[model samples]
Target: MSEATETEKPASSSNTTLTNAQKARIERNRAKAENLRQAKLVTHPYKIGPNGGPEGNSVIKVQGTKYIDSGGGFLLEQPVLPAPGQKSNAEAETPVVIDDGINIPVKYEECLDCGDQFADSYLFNNFGHSVCDKCRDTEDRHSLITRTEAKAEYLLKDCDFDKREPPLRYISRKNPHNVRWGEMKLYLHLQVLKRAMDVWGSEEELMRQHESREDKREVGKARKYNKQMKQLRMEVRSSVYTKKTTELHVHEFGPETYNEEEDNYTHACVSCPYTETFEKM
Candidate 1:
């Protein structure tokens, strides 16, 4: 009976210890539930109106952050303040940055006039010429020439500019004279001269070809003028004069002459100066 009582006493102490541990766990769970409820409850600092709504302003401060009612069933946080001495986004200028993710090395060309290496220039961009912008002479050296003018002045055909090996480059622009007209193709004057030399062999040869063409053109013009004048004269004569049909005339022989050496006979017509010679066969 003593051993059983001692065992019962140990069991009672063990039960007491378990009860205290369970009570501690329950208290901790209750504190956690209260914290969750407080976090879920949103409190607005503004005064409540009679209609049980926030007064005047739609702004609300939560967790030290101010948020405005977005009116679309959501709240928007206030814009972050810009750093001191830095311009606001609206007033700041956005810099343009180009990133192609390519590390291609730029090739430079020596300018014809300046003899300086450059990566790009107006003439180079438009015509693939090596002349830099500073040395470009738009009115003289690097002047633009119309395709028609180039062809006419250089005596170059379409094949020379387009079909030849390494075809020439040109720029197109709307016709200044008439916008409705076809766009005009412009080529560099110096390049045109070089192409002309290539086609004609030399500047002297080109000049000679030009002179020969001019002479032929003049002759053709004169011939055309003469033909036109002849047509005009014939028209005038036809309008002023009337034609009269006449019967064919029969020649009347006046006499016959004998050629002893040739052994032939010749006869002369009486009404006209018509003569006839015949051999008696």
Candidate 2:
């Protein structure tokens, strides 16, 4: 009985050793397969559009090739599936709405020159015309006057004076009689000059305020001139006289009463005595 037990124990030990060796071999092959998989590369397919068709049917399809490595020993290529028959080239053959200048919709009106929609049009002030902004800017560059210049001209027109003379004063006159007209003209000229000065002064002030400390010296004269002009205008307005004259004049005519030798003579004041004689009577 003891000898049979010893033989069985040795047989069981040999079986255990064989089983462990087989497991180690299997594990090594698995590790080799995992390493090959990590080194393997894959490629994906590219696609374009799946635009809709007239019948409302649409389809998406992938093009190009794909390759996969199952193991180091084998390379497999994926088979391409043809697009479904219902996905025929319907999108490519679909008809687009085109206008033939007749029966065209109002919403689709396009500019003839630019090929852009009419809704994006702009109005040009020069010709009082409508055009696209791009075309308008181009025209403005070649225009005789830009929008800014046009605005300035309009402003000047607003303050322009009539060339015709005023009513009831057909003859040329001077001094006190034409004083009102002269004063009015002078006032208008002064107002215009004042506005011009203010505009210039504002621009200069802006430049001076923005300049560096080193550049402010360049603006000193302009600052001084602006100050002097403002002061002068104020003083003139306060001290100027704008009175109207009211005096009568009489002309005397006596025949052959001139002093021949001197050719000139002075007259004396005259008085009446009828009231005093009547009172005495």
Candidate 3:
């Protein structure tokens, strides 16, 4: 043979046998390790998607030369999809972790809120929790990007939310007895938009460090508050999704509490384009 690679590693010449107790101990240790691995809170460095160039673009030579001469197979077209009831070989088989000598360890991760186990690669940008992709979709989310921040904040603080608007109209096709179902839906949607302010307020407080304190006994209280607020924000996307329509009844600011200087807000989404429609009304 020209050379034996890792995939072709030879088996040990000596035969070995383990006692039942030893085998049981190994199984126990594996279970314990798997549990601990799933409980990790922070993201690991190695568990990342392909970010750079050549390594990420895994280009296999489809058509190459013999020695240095000709070409190969697989290229020029998009991959063919499998038939309805069929699956790719990779999906059909059960997972098997193999130690091909070089060693690629199996990985597991868990969401903090839902405690669901998933590959770390499926992790999404969670609002305030160590959540998975599924939880991230439902949890309240606060997007702090350059594009969304201004609009979200305006809808949060300056909007005159408490000002009730004209009721929305919709039809119920299911049953005549459920004719008012459309009205109930409108109320539900209104509540969802109102919650956007709640999410926005929590985020603002965390950023403003309003919860921060300098007392001898409360030096770290602010940080703890910040964490609580951050976690609370993770539910924002879910709140927004519950009622998708945008309207002026959605309030982000008022005089009763949170911030004292926000007196200009009259409980509605004003100054914001969302309130422009209500300006004439």
Candidate 4:
């Protein structure tokens, strides 16, 4: 009896120990059975009409209750239809209420040109200038100027436009002259003029500075021209002379000869074609 029991225990242990694949398959089968049981709990209580009529179109009448055939195998229970003059449960649920009166009033800005309060305008939105769109004059007063033009005409530096107390606003645009060039920054001409006045203290001061700079520029150009001419002359003179540094020809004269009329001793260099004449008392 003891020997038989030992053999039976080994056999039972071997049978109980399942492989990984067998375990996974058993788990999958158990999950499928549970899903089937859950599906059976909710009986599709709708049914189709005897004839293919309108009643069988979008609904399935299983047993007695009407179930919506949602195209797929799934069916939805028919909700209790609300009587006439009554909203459905979905419609009866109050929608989120947002009172417009509770919202804070929007602050309107006074337009510089029109003197009318406006909530939004192109100039106000882009450049912070409280001007209405009707007063926006792209051709003159409210015109846009390129950064280069602003710098040249107003004598404003990068700091004036960017690093000043209140930096000027600008819009970036693709270079109109050449798309390959870097983007161009455009600023309001009116703002640039105002900034220029601030930088130079007044329009008169700006004009005086312009005149001074122009005179200095002319003087610089003249000086540069003179320098260039001087360099050109030096180059031409050097080319003509062809300066050479050869060992000095120490007058290795054969003999010093006296001139009869001139009364001077003359000597010629033997190594180079150089001659010298001198008078000695």
Candidate 5:
């Protein structure tokens, strides 16, 4: 009787177990999750060969690094080609014809007055006018006409109208004793009358004085000279008529009348009664 001690029963040897259908379902779910992950992988740029194959099968080699896609296996390469009746990209971009007008060199000439380079058609001679045709036409119309007319009128009005005279005759008068009494007297007394020409301060002043007494003085002197000349001409005509000779006639003798032969008189003085006296003297 071992003091009636309690003894533990031996543990039962039972193992936990699952059905076969449950294990197959778990394997199928794991395969589906792996396929989804492979679809999400991105494709990168790659080179290809002529036979429509990637440079290195399904694996991309970038800087010696290999990237593999487990799902698609490999990607094919397609070469880009031009469409029918279409030019190639390089040929289409090239220009066919160049602009020949731009390449031609232009010719020019120097202007005579301004010494500036201008086209051949632009060259012109001004002659008396100072400005060009375009400038003259565009500017005042009276400019060209006024200057030309002024010069012409001035020349016409200022022309010398006085004539030359003949040489002086040194004739001596006979006295009672058969000796020469009077000194030699020149036949012609043509004088350039130096009448006081009005000296105005300016052109405007002269124009203002043209209607004054100074202008009248000039006119009076001209009239007196003309009257005296007419009287002398009448005297010569009277003498010629009285002589009843066609060759010999009367001439001016020191503001007086003198008889001279026609053969001695080569030409007549315009202002005086002498015949070519001033010119010969």
Candidate 6:
């Protein structure tokens, strides 16, 4: 090699300088990472992931935000409550106890058809069998027009306000159109039923405790435990219930669906007797 010139005797460091484009790209990446970090911090607010430290700064994280269906091909960007007319998949999946002109749902003891709650002497059915006031009235009016009898007899079996209905049953002409009314029951209030369920759980716990203490030989102690169990049973039997009415938009009357010949006249001739059928013509 030739001898170096006076001013260029030694070479500078060999590290390559970054171009303007490269620098700009690096800056954009850094800003994106910082924004992600801030979002993660906001969502969690407690602790960051394992790669949150400065030593692991290259690993960027984006917090997950819950999304709901927007009825489009993609999910909504943010979470939102379902629209009033729409029901979540979860709510729609619950089993419903359907009745004539009504639907009794244990969720709120409201009518599945009209979302009305049961109350008072308007109806007497066993648990889980409920018809709303409006639906029941409609059915009664329809029954008056269609049933063989003007008013069906209601044999009261058990009746205690908010707690129990008198064991009630009625015998009609045993028509194929009507169901066995004796075995059917109305759904209790949701919150009250929840209370009863909690009481049942407590009763079970108490029973376990009683069983554990059974080894003791005190006759009076046994009596006390028996009394406790009786009380719990009575509590379960006498649990309070509720009645509520909620107006929800439901499907209109359709002979093929909502109203059959059994209760409504949609599919039957209006002036025809209960024994009569509509002509195909």
Best by TM-score: 4
Runs of candidate 2 with Cα error greater than 4 angstroms are 1-77, 80-144, 156-281
lDDT of 1 by residue, 1-281 (tens): 99999889988888677577789999999999998987665544344555545544677789998776655677867554567688777667677678868888999999988799999899999999988999999988889999999999999999999999779999999999999999999999998999999899998999999999999999999989967875776676674446655749877997789998866689999989989776553
Per-residue C-alpha lDDT of model 6 across residues 107-132, encoded as one tens digit per residue: 44666556765453233342333555
> Local error of candidate 5 at 261, Å?
55
User: Positional deviation of 45 in candidate 1, in angstroms?
Assistant: 4.0
Q: Once model 2 is optimally superposed onto the true structure by TM-score, how far is the C-alpha of residue 163 displaced, in angstroms? A: 29
Which 10-residue window in model 1 sums to the lowest lDDT? 43-52
TM-score of 6: 0.14
Give TM-scores for every candidate, taking all chains together and pairing residue i with residue i: 0.54, 0.17, 0.18, 0.56, 0.22, 0.14
User: Which candidate tops lDDT?
Assistant: 1
Candidate-wise lDDT, in order: 0.83, 0.42, 0.42, 0.81, 0.42, 0.43
lDDT-wise, the better of 1 and 4 is: 1
Better of 4 and 5 by lDDT: 4
Give me candidate 3's TM-score against the actual structure. 0.18
Task: Give residue 130's lDDT in candidate 1 (0 to 100).
Answer: 89
Candidate 5: residue 253 lDDT (0-100):
45
Give Cα distance to truth, residue 179, candidate 6, Å. 52
Candidate 3 structure quality by residue, lDDT tens digits, 1-281: 54655435444322356678989999999999998976543332223344421222223344551111112332332233456688975676868788678767766677776888776523332222245766654223522222123334334332333333322122223333576543221112223344554555655654554334235337567768856765565466357547768664655532222333522223334344332111000
Better of 2 and 4 by lDDT: 4
Number of clashing pairs, model 5?
A: 10
Instruction: Report each candidate's C-alpha RMSD, comma-separated, in the order given.
Output: 19.7, 23.7, 42.1, 22.2, 30.2, 39.2
lDDT of 2 by residue, 97-160 (tens): 8876667555433544576755544342222234555654443332333222322432333223
